[model samples]
Target chain A: MYKLICKDGNAKRGEFTTVHGKIQTPVFMNVGTAAAIKGAVSTMDLQEIGTQVELSNTYHLHVRPGDEVVKKLGGLHKFMVWDKPILTDSGGFQVFSLAGLRKIKEEGVYFNSHIDGKKIFMGPEESMRIQSNLASTIAMAFDECPPHPATREYMEDSVARTTRWLLRCKNEMNRLNTLEDTINKHQMLFGINQGGTYTDIRVEHAKRISELDLDGYALGGLAVGESHSEMYRIIEETVPYLPEAKPTYLMGVGTPANILEAVERGVDFFDCVYPARNGRHGHAYTNHGKMNLLNAKYELDDRPIEEGCGCPVCKNYSRGYIRHLLKAKEMLGLRFLVTHNLYFYNKMMEEIREAIENQNFASYKKKKLEGFAAEQGN
Target chain B: MYKLICKDGNAKRGEFTTVHGKIQTPVFMNVGTAAAIKGAVSTMDLQEIGTQVELSNTYHLHVRPGDEVVKKLGGLHKFMVWDKPILTDSGGFQVFSLAGLRKIKEEGVYFNSHIDGKKIFMGPEESMRIQSNLASTIAMAFDECPPHPATREYMEDSVARTTRWLLRCKNEMNRLNTLEDTINKHQMLFGINQGGTYTDIRVEHAKRISELDLDGYALGGLAVGESHSEMYRIIEETVPYLPEAKPTYLMGVGTPANILEAVERGVDFFDCVYPARNGRHGHAYTNHGKMNLLNAKYELDDRPIEEGCGCPVCKNYSRGYIRHLLKAKEMLGLRFLVTHNLYFYNKMMEEIREAIENQNFASYKKKKLEGFAAEQGN
Candidate 1:
């Protein structure tokens, strides 16, 4: 269930309730691609950092540990030891992007697994089944993520096929929920809107998917090499057609600046690998842009990653020590940065929510963007 | 200062006070080579897992980030954010073993660093100066670690040189502590006893070092390629010559069984890489022997690393989940196992101390050894 608490212009504040827990939005779901946060972070660390939701990849879980194995071990919640709500994406994106030699048909797509080069088939029903086995709080509708820079004709065809697949996924999910053996009988489905850079196709697709009255909607395939202005324009054009009562998730949309822009355009849920990935490379996000810990300038600097921050790493460690750790190639350096970066994102979301509730989100967004720009000179 | 609380035969229960903190005797020092526990664990994690003393490598720190850099940034205690007693080993072991083409001389060993292959010299005074810059609570005396299978003549010459180095180390440490700019003004020195596996040489070296009345004494060069029985016999023969009032450390001595054997032989302090190293490789130490999480048998086993264990990992994670992480190449798996293994060692030492205080260490040692042997079938 979704509750719209307040709004400041197009920026919306919301709360999403699930079987696991209630997540306050606008929220950033920390991406734990394989049921564990990369950079050696645990669920306990997630809780300590004020993370509300965790997003895992269905494709990765289905491939290595197998969704069936996760089900036998009591689903992703018990498997990961986190009682917080989790959102598992449909395996379509990974299968389309990561797998080798894929052929798409009405029944399903046939491709070889990226991990082992083994053939596998996944249709709407199969994706739904794997997700049902994973039994996450939210199961995304299976849809093909069309590559960027596609023709209008190809975009139209892909959107049509995705709509049909969404229908099948909805039906399969309803049936699966009624089964006695289903792990999450109340699993929520969120349909994805895909139309590449074509604004007309995106609006049409958004309107069509809104008719199904799903629990949530997501704008996917937007951050795939598209310019930031084009992505923002597409979101502005497409979001008005979707129902505002449900949550709006922006999939794989990145950067603190991008998040601020998308949130202003009414995107309520977000998940990206930039924070975790960049953290591994020794880049730490701060209020004043990003700081690379590997820089020699921080060798003798005894400041936290960000002064006046509330994260555990900031409270206890110094940039000098962290720099030493990174130079020594200690994994804790990456872990520390990851924890700080996630906390930065999560805290920003909290501030965003507070600004929306206070009806000052526009100024908050402007000042936050200026803060980053002032340091990054972008 | 060392206080003897009680004793059961040779096993002693005591407490040693340092400037940083007081350490319970029969303590196991968690090896944090290069100022970090190898398996992505932080000092905060160490505190949570009840780690008493953190042992760092003088060689590793000197080579990377450099000890001078650590001093400028405030010292190892602040550098690693650990306030507990830290014991930095003299660079002697690493120079003898890890360095390339080392030439041992009376002034000190001349060799190239293992990391950068930079030509460097580290005699007793140099080792003391580096450790002083790091500002650790206790610094081991710089001494050569004689290689195994050495001729009697070689053993005698190496031991004589080590004794001379110990005298130099004591003088340097005392002078460094008196300096106005030294970070740790009251730094303590622990002399090392190294005579290969020859009992007569070992006894003479121990007696000669004990006469210096340093804060502590250590038996080095025992666990290097020697039979377990032979190593145990050497400990039995050499520990008595060292001062019973001061702590005796068994350097690089290993395994749960090995620690128990050494404890029964009157060794009160121990440092080894076994728990953290074995854990990174998927080996977990338990009361009932060691379990390799990489083994296929643990794939579907839904049990903790050890049931009824008070470790944070055991309290939250399952063997099945950890095995999944390992198979998927997740660092959290190694981290969980390492935390659990260190807790296992620390908890065992606590039990040993308690058993000694209760005056039943012999029976306790027998029972603990039987527990490990029963599962390992050794």
Candidate 2:
């Protein structure tokens, strides 16, 4: 399913084939957490912005529509009408971060739903079953994402339980694939590596998960309140131990610069909600840096979000018009900025892949990062 | 500027030439009050849904971006990036409906801005000058939209003042259109007729306005707390007095049935916020009737919002999917429904135009109204 096309130092260009479609490596999965981009961006708009894969949340969908309901209606792809590669994260991250805590037993965790505070328990088997019903191209393992600044003892214990959860998740997914009513019978399971910010623990966890021969691997606990240098160092220490044949994903991992740095560290897939979230608050990411639409300088500026951006929004809309919409609390403002930012990220990935193929990724990453860090003009 | 092609009884098929573009008669002008559709629909999306004319509010734009800001950035057509003809209503409606305190005098009206509570005064000349800054294809005259249940004595004085305002609006518009810096040098003026629900007052006002030979005329103060039959009676009584060479407009109106009945009564142009507004609340107008997505019956229904409808939303999305998004408070739900409802309305107008061309408007109106009033099924 995973094919490495070329390598330039540690920056690899590759493609992964899923049942839905083929995804180029060094790709960004547009986040549509509750089956829609938070800022009124539809899947149709996603297509216009060069989106390859859409990432959805297991917790939100399972709680609102229920996995059973989604299964009955077809699947997440059909539900959202996104006929592309879709990766669904295990409810683990949301369960740990959003839900009200109760207890974490050897089997799973018990908590209240963040939406309504209703009692709910999610074990590895339950998580796998929900993903099975969602029937996404990739289903992540139900692993506990330990917070940063954890002691070695807690890290060791969490990593061990995560391993056990991976085994259970893999076993359950295998069973669900053979069921007659399963939406995506070939739904692939990916194991997650969690070690907080401990480099040695991350490397050991990576090696242990690599031994399972899963379809892919993900660094789960980085970017959870850790510094950028710490996250980059951990990725460098851990990635070499993981199998090069499978795709490497960075979970809930960040900024345009962060993606550039991670791709150089051999990570393949990434997703984040910052584009839509920031757009809703009137922030836009241009090649020269981010700018706030609320600033008075943009009130009469007639240029696009980015001068050379090829996105639909930047192609026809002006900064002044979008700024007026934002001031008036119009939804189209959020929609335009969200569409523009996602296009910026996706285009960044496209450029990254081309640079790696031409063996100039190092210079490309440096130049792009510098451009992004530079102050923007009106 | 008006060209009559044919007539099916009172319902005529024709075209009206404007500075921006030619508009098909019996048209439904999509309302973009405050410079945007209520449910995040953009000008690009408007084009895809077969929208011809876009209607904006003078009051909202004047208060927020302000007409001077728009004029500096270019006009409403340039600001919105919509090349089609735009019709901007006089600020009178919003000033009366939304502003805090207002005092009417022979010169003008004084009111506090609903947004910032700042003092503002506007009269016929001020409205025309603002609309000149907007540079829409048609600028409505500044006329009082008298409240429903108004006494005959109040209606008598209001109509006389409105007639005076109409003359001043026409004179101001002529001066602005000839100015060297005017955004649209050929901007046309549209006079409004207002008489509450009194047939005699409405007929007399219509005849008086028709004598001015304005580009278009609108029946204001209808559909404001008045019964459908009473409003229909006023249209039936007053439309004949308006010149056949000019387009007749009905302001802030109505359902599918209301539009159909008014068209047969000789109305040509229409504007309303119902489709976008009702769509935000999950009420959809289908061939059968209204469908509320909030109902649990749509939980497992995989059909489109309206089967056989060619709108973008209906073509690729399902009822179950939209229902899930609505339940989760996702914006895409409102967006999809809004797009569908607008498509339904625009398509209805297209069908109305075609039926008049085919000389079957009366039968078409009957069949459509019955379908819209029927019980919708899954």
**Each candidate: chain B TM-score:** 0.98, 0.99
Among these predictions, the greatest lDDT belongs to: 1
TM-scores for candidates 1 onward, in order = 0.99, 0.99
Using DockQ as the measure, the top candidate is 2
What is the lDDT for A131 in model 1? Answer: 94
List of clashing residue pairs for candidate 1: none
| Deviation from native of the Cα of residue B324 in model 1, angstroms | 0.4
Q: Which stretches of candidate 2 lie over 4 Å from their true place?
A: none
TM accuracy, model 2: 0.99
lDDT of each: 0.92, 0.91
Binned by DockQ into CAPRI classes (incorrect, acceptable, medium, high), candidate 1 is: high
